[model samples]
Target: MTAPNPSTHDQAARLVEAVNEALTPATSYRDASLLPAVGPTPPVPQPGRPPMSQRATDASALMLTAGLATAPPGLIAIGLLVASGYADPLVIGMICAAPAVIAVPVLAVARLLRGAQGIGAEHHHHYNGPVSQHTVHTETKTRGLFAKTINKQ
Candidate 1:
């Protein structure tokens, strides 16, 4: 997919031009727009990334916030479970979600607190752009262990 060579880039650019040329006929476009009954003028299409990135960031922040707020519920559940006579719903939920509960304080004190600093900016009047960096998180599962890293060369 990486067209490093000049010849391939020229070909790709030519192909796009050809496709765009074929898509619009002067008469066809003019005829459609000539109708005075149409509503306000249509907005122009701008070239850039779609708005999905903002939405994705919002969703991630929301999920993480929800997870951080449920710190004490998990601890209480585990405590009640261990003190129960035989069986209980609280105990079962506690056992299943124990890991998540234990991680709440760490998540708040470390990651949440760190990320909060970036949320505010009096100097950033125009745009607070994304900070790009290359990183990798490796994990070992039943399938196997893997080292995932970015190679930008």
Candidate 2:
């Protein structure tokens, strides 16, 4: 069977419906204060690391990018010359094309690395990072089938 072809408005409406469903809280969970407290919160201690210097990072990145940019041209030249000795056009064509094809990804990666390096890794407090011993005490409503069997045994 062919897939249903939804119009742009239909797609948008479906998306809105899904968003509304997600935003609306469950009736049971509407009053969170009604639930009993679970055990004490788990401790999440931050691991300390020696701070890195931005100058050192930038220098290394510059050196790496320079090396990447030069390596491909040198390899392509050498590879074609070596492959030409085999007297195979197919081998020579493949060898010539391989470096050119790989060059795009290499440059993209170098650009990405440069951009990331430019945004110096200063410690920012990310939301999903370790939460201080704050417990959102909510208990599971039902036990697992295995859990019920285990308790009986």
Candidate 3:
């Protein structure tokens, strides 16, 4: 059967919305006061790591975006490899690992690019920093899934 006529972005949004909507609240507001949040509901100890499921989803999306696993441009490499009909197993192995090898550098460079783009590496308690020193509680604080650059003098 043909796929539904949904915009790519719309389709992704709908999928996420469905999963999020399906998440039943374990506690009512009143019950929350009497019980501690447990399981996946607890705050992440390390702010730089996305939740496991989200991380996997994000990786899949990245692969799709990078064209390593989709579309006309993506098929070019596969077509080249199969067309080559190389006798050397090493040559084929290199062809298969090529995507992953390139991906690592791309991801690394993306992180480096983020640094150039002024994304800080770590959370720090400073007057100019986001959280004030007095209010900085470790358990309550978290940041994004990227590196944190904390420059404490």
Candidate 4:
């Protein structure tokens, strides 16, 4: 047979080297020179979404919630102004009080969401890519009406 492709030959050689290395047991665990060099793991290639820090994410959530919490009071003030054609002091006071009543729970939700990192099983989305082989995929089977009747008989 003609000589194998150069690239294929190189790959075969590398594969054999790897297999030989794997098969050979370590002879000296106590020898410092024989041990593999320790270093920081090389970063995995993250193809999308620049990483957001926990603090940054928490801050963003807090700001968003704070803005949303202000909306109800703002809308109330606007409604009062439109109805009476003036910014009455009592109505303005009520508008200010509305936010205070709801602020605590809304802020608490933002805090909870921030602290919830790594709390639950990772939820897979369509963009998360193919499921790993280790994951279980469960499906329910249903029989057609005719098939069910035939099986029963």
Lowest-sum lDDT 10-residue window in model 2: 144-153
Over 10-107, each residue of candidate 2 has an lDDT whose tens digit, in order, gives: 99899999999999987775555655477577756667533458887788789989989997887777777776785466766786699789999999
Tens-digit lDDT track of model 1 for 20-103: 988877664334556567788885767864445788978878999999878688667667766785658675776778879888
lDDT of each: 0.72, 0.74, 0.71, 0.78
| RMSD (CA, angstroms), candidate 4 | 23.8
In terms of TM-score, the best-performing candidate is 4
Superposed on all Cα atoms, the candidates' RMSDs to the truth, in angstroms, are 25.6, 28.8, 25.3, 23.8
The TM-score between candidate 2 and the true structure equals: 0.24
The lDDT, on a scale of 0 to 1, for candidate 1 is 0.72
Ordered by TM-score, highest first, the candidates read 4, 3, 2, 1
Please, what are the lDDT tens digits per residue for candidate 3 over residues 1-153? 987666987989999999987796655445445564566675647876555797797987787787754567646766676678744658667877998999999999989987785546987544665753444434424477885756444
- Once superposed on the true structure, which residue ranges of model 4 sit more than 4 Å away at CA? 1-50, 87-153
Q: Is candidate 1 or candidate 4 better by lDDT?
A: 4
* Residue runs of model 1 more than 4 Å from their true location after superposition: 1-52, 84-153
Cα misplacement distance, residue 113 of candidate 1 (Å): 40
Give the candidates in order of lDDT, highest first. Answer: 4, 2, 1, 3
Q: List the residue pairs that clash in candidate 2.
A: none
**Tens-digit lDDT track of model 4 for 33-129:** 7655876888676986457898988888899999999989878868878788777778677867887879989999999998887747877557567
Candidate 4's TM-score reads 0.26
